[model samples]
Target: MVGRTLTAVAKLSTVPAWVRRPLPAVAGVEDFLLRLYRRTESAEALAGFIALSWLGGEAADGPLLWAAPPEERFARAFLAVADALAEGESYPPPEWWRAEAGCLAPMTEAQWNERAGSWPERFYAHGVVCALGWVLGVFDDPAIMAPLHCGDGRSVGYGPREEWRVRLRACAVPLHLRNEEIAEWLRSGAGSQSGPAAVGAARATPSRSTG
Candidate 1:
């Protein structure tokens, strides 16, 4: 099954770069996440998995799947799987069942924020540790909020309450962008700088691992 999944992934990778360019950067991150899910089988793991998958890489069918919104039962089942795994109990559902019944429900922003907080501290710790790989301007892109909305209201609206806002705040300063540098860049008043430098400092500074 693993081999088959890898084969499928490889086949998908062969598609035109132009076509794939818009897809979320799921390759490296997804692979790591899948292993984590298989091992831990926790709801937070599943949430992260689905969220990342939803965000990464565009397939011909990608938009359609994403269009469904994370409100469906399938999304809920995935979360239940994570919950079961975290508890160290055998999954209560039947072998053929993947997720809990009626798991899929449209999330509100407030709900998403609640779940984000609910995830075991370990996952966020790991996320904060691994967040260094994100490139400059990655968080600045508005699309990053899509998966975060996974049935929650906290993920929407303008300004900082969004998941990206928190992630950018927690991860950006330590990973690539320095606080002083970011402040300077914001204050530069260059009438909107573009490219990498605008997102972060010219020099890449490694941050302490939250792990």
Candidate 2:
């Protein structure tokens, strides 16, 4: 079925056919993801799969999934799928999901005006990701978060402690952080000045992977 709901995903108890239509190259990946869906019916895993479909099989920004409030899981079994998807890794949920989702939720509702001439900078399909569940944000080809600072252009939206491992592609970085540190950094005016320059210097750094 096309354009189904969370309720539908849980009810039908299977990955919708629409998602698997465009996918061809990955042998058995679809079956694996589908089995995982059928077994656990996780909201986050479903959300991640939907986002993967929208990304046209290319790694865009994330494997983002919706993590319902912990309070919601008292009766539901959604987290099981998220756990299975994670295999064994662990990380935290996104910042947006943890709170009441005050402003970020509204941004997802805003008009789809992002454009890049004939190309779309954001995307019309991104609505699906938000609709399935909230996405923290998309990073083109993000670097592993070294400092774990969600500064000007950098951000993180961690999932549950157990499920964090599954959402690593969501750019889960590790670093103990403090609000005061971010405030001081911004107040010092280092964000604007050093952000891009630091990025440039990082690019100039020897390739850790190659070296």
Give the candidate number with the greatest lDDT.
1
The residue-by-residue lDDT of candidate 2 on 17-136, one tens digit each, is: 432211231112223333344544443334434443433323223232332222222101222222222232222244533443322222221121212111111121222233222222
Best-fitting candidate, scored by TM-score: 1
Q: Determine the C-alpha RMSD for candidate 1 after optimal superposition of all C-alphas.
A: 15.6
Which stretches in model 2 have alpha-carbon errors above 4 Å? 1-3, 6-30, 57-211
lDDT of each: 0.35, 0.31
Global lDDT for candidate 2?
0.31
Report the lDDT tens digits of candidate 1 across residue range 106-170.
33445334434543432422232122112222234323322222122223245422543454334
| CA shift of 211, model 2, Å | 49
RMSD of each: 15.6, 20.4
